[model samples]
Target chain A: MANDHILKRFDEELERLNATINEMGGLTEAQFAKALQAVRDRDTAIAEEVIADDARVDALDVVVQEQTVKMLALRQPMAVDLRVVLSSIKIAAALERIADYAKNTAKRSIVLAQGSAPPSAVAGIDRLGRLVRAALKDVLDAFADDDVAKARDVWDRDEEIDQVYTGLFRELLTYMMEDPRTITACTHLLFMAKNIERAGDHVTNIAELVSFRNTGQNFAEARRKGSGALYTTDTAP
Target chain B: MANDHILKRFDEELERLNATINEMGGLTEAQFAKALQAVRDRDTAIAEEVIADDARVDALDVVVQEQTVKMLALRQPMAVDLRVVLSSIKIAAALERIADYAKNTAKRSIVLAQGSAPPSAVAGIDRLGRLVRAALKDVLDAFADDDVAKARDVWDRDEEIDQVYTGLFRELLTYMMEDPRTITACTHLLFMAKNIERAGDHVTNIAELVSFRNTGQNFAEARRKGSGALYTTDTAP
Candidate 1:
């Protein structure tokens, strides 16, 4: 009976941890969308909101990490439970960084809004943001369902985000070269694009972690260059 | 007698971990210096070496992390020893990232070397790299000597890095606006500078961890914006 009670408490804590992570992901996704909108619409209010709200995300990150540490110290869970706790800690940090990046993008948007006309070159930025958000969503879903196939799909999407970033880079460069006045805003957009690119990388990290949790096998092949095909490997098999 | 033997083994393992970290820091410092020279002097060979040698740094990071984990699992260290093991893991990851940034800067040097005039605007980048490298060295020194004051000094130096990054942003913007032909290389340089700036931030993270390990206090003041003061007040004092 005592063993059963302990197991029940462990399960409850795990559930609570997952709930917090998902809530944090939702907040991050909302901020990412607002950041893009702020850039496109030149909405300084929204940009400032994103920046101010970053503290909340930072606080949540600290809370989640503390909880994970406590669980490690108290429970000393092994295998799957241990991996989940470890992954939660890292993924929480990654999400907080993503929020920071979004806030940075919003800050740039404010500067760009105060300056010259919005450059048409930012179309790629919007697309990249959507791609990364979708990737994050997919990774979260995979985590909830333990669907390794879905995680693999998220990993595959990173290449697309990278391509969009490359195209955006070229377009932004052309804009900056054409007019010196556009330099400040265009450079800000460049950072925003890089942030989105990094968010996609984080999503990939989450997906890899999900796969590891479902399977004991290490995904060493996916860590290398030109490893795009490795992302297609179905962890279900 | 068994407890005494375990304590001795734990101390020896801790000493080994510290030595490895110090060695890793030295290698990273050397790499950063060589990367800066490669950019300034257009030394392709040195740049290539930095790129090729990144694997060693990554491997060292893995080894350090594994050792720390083993200690935690086997020895079950408490209080200060536990903090030391945990902080070592985080510090190893940060150092690996800083090394990665150095490799990134070196890679950009190759592209910059291909330019017609060596991108006259790279002076800001040079300054930023120097600042970041110095900050990293301070943080590592603090870790080695457990000097909380030196760690606080590292935190203060982050602002100088941020200032240099801001200046570099404007200069790179001008380079991109000046000519479309310079776009590809200038964009690369921008990413490199951002990487270095991020490396500095990671050093700050290490500094905070050092403080946390020494004192049970979290030092929440470090998270405040524009708190560029070189000294931290001990709450107990």
Candidate 2:
């Protein structure tokens, strides 16, 4: 009877921990959405809101971390339960980091909105932001459903985001070279694009966590990475 | 007598955990140093060594994480013990990421070494890398000694690194604009400088974890961040 009671309490704490992480995930997703909207609409007001809301995501991250520690200390969960709690901490941190990258992208919008950015650059930024946001949503769904296949799909798709980013990087460099006046705006756009690429990396981090939660092992080999021409040149393969 | 025995066992496990983290920190510092040397001396061999050393850091991170979870699950540590275990996981992950940045910096050295990089740009990168390596060392020492003040010192010093990075960024852009022939080399330097800056950020992350472990509270207010001119222009503040 005592063992049964202990197990019941453990289950309750696990549910609460899961709920806290889910809430954190929701806030992070909302923040990223607002950030993307801010960029697309060139609305500094929305950008500021996204920045302000980042505090909330940071706060929720703290809550998730605290709850995971509490569960581990109190319940002493083993095996899968242990993985879930540990992964919760990692997933929350990844979500919070993704939100930070989104905030970073929004931060650039203030400066970028002032300049006359080219239509092609703006479209490129929007496309990359859209894909990253989609990946974030899918990873969250995978977490909710404990779907390893879905998580793996998100992991595999990061290569496409990287390819898009590489194209944008070269395009921006060309613009700056042609027109010195475009340097500042183009630089901000480059940072914004890099921020989005990092957010994609964080999405993959969450995917890896989801995989760990469902399966007891990490991916056996190095995950496939798209060729980054910037760093790959001159390397002896 | 039985209670004393349990406490003794707990102390031993905590010591093992601490030792593992310190070892990880040592490896990370070494990687960053080799990466810096690769940039300074243009030694691709050292760069390759740094890249290969990264796997060892990754392996150690997994070991620390597994040990932390095992301790939490088996011992159900509370109070300071609980904080140590939780923070160890955070700290180990931070160290692993720092190593990654080092690897990234090293990777760029391969391409940068192939071309004629400016002596001044190389010096600038060396300076930034040195400071970040110092910060990593201090933070790790702070962790080992549980010295919150030392950790806070490292945290506060990150601004200097950021200021250096901003100056370097502008300088590199000017170089590229003045001489298009310098573009490729300057671009590689720019990425390497950014990698060093990011490594500084990871150092601060470890500092924050150290502070939290010692004090059980995060910083009272938002951590002071150096103003980034790349993104913050004409903002209605």
Candidate 3:
């Protein structure tokens, strides 16, 4: 009976952790959506809202970490439970980082909003932002459903994000080269686009964690690198 | 006697974990140094070396994580010991990220070498890169000695890096506006400087982890923000 009670409490805590992870993901999704809209529409109001909401995501990460440490100390769970518990910390950290990147874009968006930006550059960044947000949504679902296939799919699709970013990179350079007057706003747009691509990379990281949690296998050997990925990431083979 | 023996093994494991972390840090330090030199000298060979050496840091991170999980499962340490074990993971992750940023700089350095970059922009990034490396060294020492003061110092000094970065950001823009031909190289330099700033932020993160590990007190409340940090980070209190 004591063992049963302990197991019940463990399950409850696990459920709570899962729920919190979802909340963080959901908040980041909303934040990124607002951030993207702010960038697309040049809406500082939405950008400010996105900026303020980042703290909540950070707070959620703290919540997740505290719970993870408590569970590790108390439960000392082994095998799959252990992987899930540890992965929660990694996933939450990754999500917080993803949110951080979104916040960065929002900050730049405010600056971009204040000035006139090159249309092609703005449109290019919007495409990148939407793609990044879509990847975030897909990876979170992969995490929730324990769908390794979906996680792998998300991992594989990050190349598309990089391809778009590289193309946009060239376009931004061309814009600055063609018109020196637009240099300031174009510079801000450049960082904003890079931040979104970095966000997409974080999504791939979450997908990797999800795959690790489900299969208990290391994906390092099987990791695939898109050629365009090196242009931005340069973090892997 | 059996308990004493088990305790001895735990101590040995922790010592090994610490060694692995130091090894990782040393490798990242060396890698960043090479990356900086590569950028300063525009030496593709050194840049290539820095890029190739990143895998060692990644592998060391794997070692730290695996050791951390095993220690947590077996030792089930509480209080300070647990914090040390946990901080090892965070520290390794941060160091790996710092190295990743350095690798990025190296990749850009290769492209910059093939072209004629503006002298002022190149000099500006060198200064930023040096400051970032110095912070990394200080934070690592703080972690090793459990020097809370040094850790706090590193945390507080990041603003200087941000200020430098912000100044460089403007200088790059001015160069791009003045000479459109320099746009490609200056843009690469711009991202390299930002990556260096981000690396400085990771040093602050390691400093925060050190403070947490030593004081067992959360310093999130004591966090400081620099005005220039907003131009770059914008992720703060």
Candidate 4:
């Protein structure tokens, strides 16, 4: 009976941690979207808002990490419980990085707003942004339901983001080659694309964590050869 | 006496972990230089070799991480010792990411070599590579000697890398705008610069770890604004 009670408390805390991570994930996704919007619309005020909001994400990261450490130290959890704690640490780190990327995008928005050249529409950044947001959502869903299949789907979708990035890279390069004046704006766009690409990777990391939590195996190592969606055929519907 | 014996063993293992990280750092520096040389000289073989060697770095990362985990389990160390073990895990993760960046650079080198347009000289990549390599060296030195001053210096040097990345971003944008044909190669160069920028950030992470290990304080929280040179400065000597 005592053991059952202890397990119940662990499960409760795990659920709490998942809730915190999901909250952080949602905020980061919104920040990413807003940062891109700020750039596209040249909204300095929104850009500043995104920059200021990063502190919240940073603070939450510290909170989640501390909770994880406390759980690990106090509970000395094993097996699935241990994996859950470890995954939370990694997921928090990924969210923190996503916030940094969003902040960077906002900073670039400010620069674009200040620049003389009119901001041109970037071909694939918006699509990439939506794709990353979806992936993150899926990962969080998988965490909530402990659904390996959903996590697997999220991992597979990363290739679409990569393909978009590749096409965007070519387009941005062409713009830069055509006019030196576009250099500054195009560079910002490039950074934005890179940030989104990294965000996709973080989503994948979360998916992998979900899989580990379910199966008690390191999915990354077992499937290292076929892990990343680097060369998948694009059939996104 | 028993506690002293365990402490001695723990310290020895910590030393070994530090040594392995430094070795990995050295290998990555060499690989960075060779990747640049291959790109500059169109040496496909050297690029291929760099890609092949990435597996070695990856393997070392696993070994170091396992060692750290084993030490943590055995020692149950508190305070500074505990921080050291935790830092080792983070540092290993950073090193693995750096190796991934190097592999990405090598893969792009192959693509650039195969492309019809000649690989134009990129002015900022080499400099950025040098900056990242130097920062890694400084962080490792700080870890080995437990020199808080050296770690502080590493933190300060991160700004220099950010400036180089900014300059590289502008230069690459100009290249792309000048000729549509140069778009693919320039995009690769841009990714390379971003990789170096990330590697510099990892070095800062290491510096922060060193401070935490020595002082038992979370440097991320304790440090004042603009005190650690994380991402604000434009120049470093």
Point to the candidate with the largest TM-score: 3
Candidate 1 lDDT over A116-217, as tens digits, reads: 744576677887888888888788888788899998888887777777777777677677667756766676777777778877888888888888877855
Rank order (by lDDT, best first)? 3, 2, 1, 4
Candidate 3 C-alpha lDDT tens digits along B62-93: 99988988888778887898988988888999
Give, for candidate 3 chain A, the lowest lDDT window spanning 10 residues: A228-237
Residue B87 of candidate 1: its Cα lDDT?
84
Q: Poorest 10 consecutive residues of model 1 chain B by lDDT? A: B228-237
Tens-place lDDT per residue, model 4, A47-139, is 878887988898889889767766776566877777778778888898888888888877766766666543444536777787887888778
Candidate 1: residue A52 Cα off by (Å): 1.8
Docking class of 1: acceptable
The 10-residue segment with the lowest total lDDT in model 2 chain B: B228-237
Kindly give the number of clashing pairs for every candidate: 2, 0, 0, 7
DockQ values, each candidate: 0.27, 0.39, 0.46, 0.32
lDDT of 2 at B235: 25
Whichever of 2 and 3 has more lDDT, that candidate is: 3
Q: Global lDDT of each model?
A: 0.76, 0.82, 0.85, 0.73
**Which stretches in model 2 have alpha-carbon errors above 4 Å?**
A217-220, A226-237, B215-220, B226-237
Q: Over the stretch A137-235, how does candidate 3's per-residue lDDT look in tens digits?
A: 999998889899999888888888888887887788788888898888888887787788888878998999998888987556645563344545443
**Models sorted by TM-score, best on top:** 3, 2, 1, 4
Ranking the candidates on DockQ from highest down gives 3, 2, 4, 1
> Which TM-score value belongs to model 1?
0.87
**How do the residues B74-123 of candidate 2 rate in per-residue lDDT, one tens digit apiece?**
78888888887888888898899899889888888988888988889889
